[model samples]
Target: MFQYVFGIPFTLLKFLLLWFWGTLKRLIPYALRWKKSIANEIVLITGGGSGIGRQTALYFARAGATLVLWDVNPDGNAETARLVRDCGMKAYTYTCDVTKREEVYRVAQRVKEEVGTVFILVNNAGIVSGKQFLHLTDEEIIKTMDVNTMAHFWTLRAFLPDMVRSNQGHVVTISSLLGESAVGGLSDYCTSKFAVRGLHDAILREMSVLDSQVKCTVVCPFGVSTGMFDGVKLRHEFLLPFMAPEYVGRKIVQAVLTDTEVLYLPPYVQLLVIAKTILPTSAQLVLEDIIKLNEATKTFTGRRQDTPKKEN
Candidate 1:
């Protein structure tokens, strides 16, 4: 079907190049296969009782990691531990609020004593309050910042020293696509997410400067199907669809095993982020409308238990 004999060689070369590239990409994952099994790898996961954290805990347990699970909810924390044990792996549960530095430090100490020094730390605990900027009170703003942004620092400070000393560990951070783009009525949520992106960048830079062997990964997913954002609407499931918790969980395990630095769920979210950075502000606003992203959370109530309680 080529135009003529002149095009024949070019077409053949292109085909050969494509085949080579495809083969190389396919081999990348295999090349990354771990020499040692994940069995007995000490992994600490926050908010492991529900949503993506819960799924990640199960995945890691099946892969043979002894888990240290933390959550504010005792019931959820215990449930995650039970699920891990059901997978034929050891698990320890702790009831600690990640936002409290002392609590996080104490738990880290206990985990070190009980499960050995954590080889992997998954900063997966997060809370969102979907209220308009004007509707947010001072306490609500502080709470959102503390839980969503500050907790990462607390956990990192508590665990990273040991990781640095061991020179063999991984840190997994769970941010959101909303970190790159904001929507109406989620100002506080967006602020918190953006802060996490900055926090992750800073951490990576510091690690690189120190030439630390502690690998880090940041996961930025679009809306997920977890009930954390259940009341939200998804106008287009094809472009920016809600991600399944299980899929997110599996990918995270793969990242930890391979030491990937960053992961974007659904892939298209990366394109959206690129567009946000390249397009003009006016064009981005129009594109945002076309994607119906700003409106997706019109009904979003966020997590049920963590909703900001109105005070007198």
Candidate 2:
């Protein structure tokens, strides 16, 4: 009884100290700005054909990292490789459907043999069906889960072992703000994003338990100007503007270099997450209504049929 009494206070004090230290770290711009070099690191990105993935690949290329791009669209993948090479960096392209486990493993082996081990694996491939729950078809739901959630498992299974063996690697998961908060007309998309978030968190914990040096970062951004959510609009644009692909790309690269574990783009989205946790159910509904959360996706005309699906 005496030990418990003393230990509880000590733990509380420790928590306060840690929180203060963390806040201080964030406040010190110079401290956070110090970034590690990725020069010559082999960086592989799924859905590198266009949008955020392509932009991120370009940034990594500029940083002197060799890039391996995987996508279902050969033409788009080739275009991305061309852009990387235009930056005076080496780039290899492979056409692979990330949703297929066998294809992921096979292509991964080819990457290992031809391009060498990937030091950074960016699981950025994702698709969204902007339909109400009842409007969504079985095929659409399955494809959404397969591309957004199951693909992560397949790619990680194929490549994470090497990272664990070498004890050096980084995994970046491109989640979304919807992953943290549910909204109407995006039930399938939300389900997949939530699953990936859970997967990323579980893997992070496992890495911690194993004392592994491999780092993981999960990015949750608001609606980006990427064609995927082209017509989607937030009710409060001034407070939460749709992010540019370039801005999101640059921030993601910065996060990787700085070893940031979780990133909420525009930063203010973090406050919304906090609000969701603290507010009662009725209060939350009121808040969502005020924000017109459900209406935001009412006009969501996703990427065009002719356009290649891009990373979120």
Candidate 3:
């Protein structure tokens, strides 16, 4: 019993030392070199018909990667594919209803047969119903959850087996800052994003435990200029402005190339969580009210019943 107790300290010390070294390596710029190449990768992006998804597809196509674009909008998805082909890269597109699990699986099989195995899966598709908790209909809430969170599950189930077997892949979840911090009038949207973060983290840990080479990245950006949050007003534009789609898109591609784990756009967005933890609950409530995040959606006339691509 005495020897077993003594071994605990040494084991903990070793773990700390290794963790410290890992952190130091990550801090060094030289350690971030690409361990995998995108030039030959087959990347599948959901909601790729427009906005950030389209921008990301463009970036990857420029990098010489093949693309499979999936969207609910036929014209938008075709346009994304055309733009990629214009870049001298191959692109295939499908009109898919992500809320339907069987449809996700069916199209995934079609992709495998036609586009080869996807080396990267970007679950960028999401829906938002900017409404007060009491104002939302039951269908709207369920639809939001189905597209934003449940669809992630379906895509992973359809594609992850190949990634697991090969032990080489990347999963990118385009979540939002609201996932971590909640505000009024965004109950349905927040609920879906919050659950998405849960799934992203779980997949990351599960992959680590299995000793798989698969990597997971969760991107949490504030309001973006993707039309989905077009009317979102921010008092501090420089510090907390709505990010441009091009900038957000490029950052996502960079994260995947460098194997970044969690990326909060503009960097300082991480401080929200820090403030919440350090401040009292009353103080936190005051901060949210002062930022007008609660009222940000008051004038929200964003596209109603809009799919991610539909906002384009």
Model 2 deviation from native, Cα RMSD in Å: 2.8
Q: Any runs in candidate 1 off by more than 4 Å, and if so which?
A: 1-36, 303-312
Minimum summed lDDT over a 10-residue window in model 2 is located at 1-10
lDDT of each: 0.81, 0.89, 0.85
- Which is the leading candidate under lDDT? 2
Q: After superposition, how far is residue 114 of candidate 3 from its true place, in Å?
A: 1.0
- The candidate scoring highest on TM-score is 2
* TM-score, every prediction: 0.86, 0.92, 0.91
Ranking by lDDT: 2, 3, 1
Worst 10 residues of 3 by lDDT: 303-312
Point out the higher-scoring one by TM-score: 1 or 2: 2
Q: Model 3 misses residue 80 by how many Å?
A: 1.0
Candidate 3 displacement at residue 310 in angstroms: 5.0
User: Mind giving the per-residue lDDT tens digits that candidate 3 earns over 1-312?
Assistant: 222344566667778888897677556663456545789799999999998899999989987899999998889899999999999999999989998999999999999998899989999888777778889999988999998899999999999989999989999998988898888888988888899999999999999899999999999998778878756665555667887888988888888888888888867889887887789989887777766768888877675444442322
lDDT of candidate 1 over 148-246, digit per residue (tens): 889999999998999888877888989888888888778988899899989988888888898988888898888777766767775564767777889
Tell me model 2's lDDT, rounded to 2 decimals: 0.89
Selected candidate, larger lDDT, 2 vs 3:
2
Q: If both were scored by lDDT, which would come out higher, candidate 1 or candidate 2?
A: 2
